[model samples]
Target: MGPHIKGKIKKTLSSLAGQSAQSLFPDLFQNESAKAESSTVIVPPPPDMNWLAHADFGEQQKRADSAPPALLALGGKPQQELIAQKLARMGYVVTTASSTAQALERLSANKYRLVFCGADAAFEEVLRFVNRLTTDQRRHIYFVLVGADLHTFYDLEALALSANLVINTRDLPSLELILIKGLRDYEQLFRPLLDILGSTP
Candidate 1:
């Protein structure tokens, strides 16, 4: 099998093994014996393959999959830094920009799954940025506008803009839950294509 297919098979097997272990022994993950066994288990790569190509492809995939989302803090430095730290602790990578221009530059050069814009940013500027993205690009990204109050933010007609989500900065304590929901929604949106890919011969 090709390296891509091999990797997929390995992932599938690993997932199945995890599920089986969890069902058979509810505390398997928390057991010291299971942890020790897992630590010692290592599988060698298949022979007669281009190891370099496989390694490179794996590295590229890791970088792409684990890349951080971009954050436009504008004038909210302290708030943005706190949010970034929280997200990092939760296993999310975040890139913070001090200004809308800087955020736009980063967005132009990279593909981010999520983008958070601070309410301090001009509503018109945020709208323009969202409008610039193509329909397909917009589909892949969740644009969020964060503010102190949704009422004031939406009253400015910014609700008519192309943001996928609107978050109140006051609700920063629940930011993790919001992020989890957003990710789940995004996954559900693309699940059909993922199912087709997994089933392909």
Candidate 2:
């Protein structure tokens, strides 16, 4: 072949090799081009109030304002905080107490629809408190006993006799459901009295 034709053949082969390389490593070529284009492009920073501006702050505040108060009479700080947070997430305004005495003080000072007492508190003290409240005919308050293992702490039969409800701490995920069921039970128990009151002048 002539020298000019030979050069043309070589150029054609080089062009074909470039196309083959691009086909074999398409991602590599695309990524390099993308990087180059991105380097020259200007991406504006996200707005500072993006989430806050779009959030339903008014509804959240209204719900917070309307949540009912509940008492968490637990023993350890960690467990108390954990239980309190869980209840708060369920929309209850939770107040935490480390001891039975503190819890009783809070109960006397403020009304609470629900009381969650941990086994860490003296069981006898909790029982006596519950008994006193029952004697006073204050059935509006629903009592629950929190324990890591219910059987480990109290005799199942005795506990069933004393406590309104028993919960295992390990089952924290079900805490909201337990609270709802307890509340429903309390409402059902008092439905007759509510009906009587409604019937009265």
Candidate 3:
């Protein structure tokens, strides 16, 4: 081929290769934008006492001397009373449920930040309640699976679509901690979006 023809062929191949590369790795291109968005963390200044720095994780579990604050409570079996009282001492608003039907009704009527379910409760009942919860575009609540295994339900994506994390009440901060940290990571990753929310508020 002539030199001019060869140069034109090479440019065409380069263009094709560039398009293929982008198709194979769209995230690499988007990551710069993600990093830029994630860099804007601006948490409110900690108390001047620097209490958080000296705070001990073990101390956090210490039974609060004061009544626990309630976020929101789900109604469930009598056994759930244990879950209710536990959260009450931690400062969550405890809602009680004797059955799954009652629990779903409460969710429709109120906004609950955390949901604790009994081991005996029907899984479909819980999933349905969660599905209803997701319809609210305004609130993003965290849900704990409470004693069920991932194996019990293979639909991890479906569960997570409604819940930020799932936990076994028996496990100490295992799934719950993961959920909390995941949320913090999300908040960190979307700090710019948060800034916009705050500004508009």
Candidate maximizing TM-score:
2
lDDT: the better of candidates 1 and 3: 1
Tens digits of per-residue lDDT, candidate 3, 1-201, equal 899999999998877774665576788868876888989976443123223234344644434324422232334434366655556555556666655667667767776656655434464576566665433432345455555443222235324445544444444333323333444554565567657666310
- State how far residue 90 of model 3 sits from its true place (Å): 1.5
Write down the TM-score for model 3. 0.47
Candidates, ranked, TM-score = 2, 1, 3
Model 2 spans > 4 angstroms off = 1-66, 120-123, 134-137, 151-161, 197-201
Candidates sorted by lDDT, best first: 2, 1, 3
TM-score of each: 0.54, 0.55, 0.47
In the range 46-66, model 1's lDDT, one tens digit per residue, is: 232232233323222223234
Worst 10 residues of 3 by lDDT: 149-158
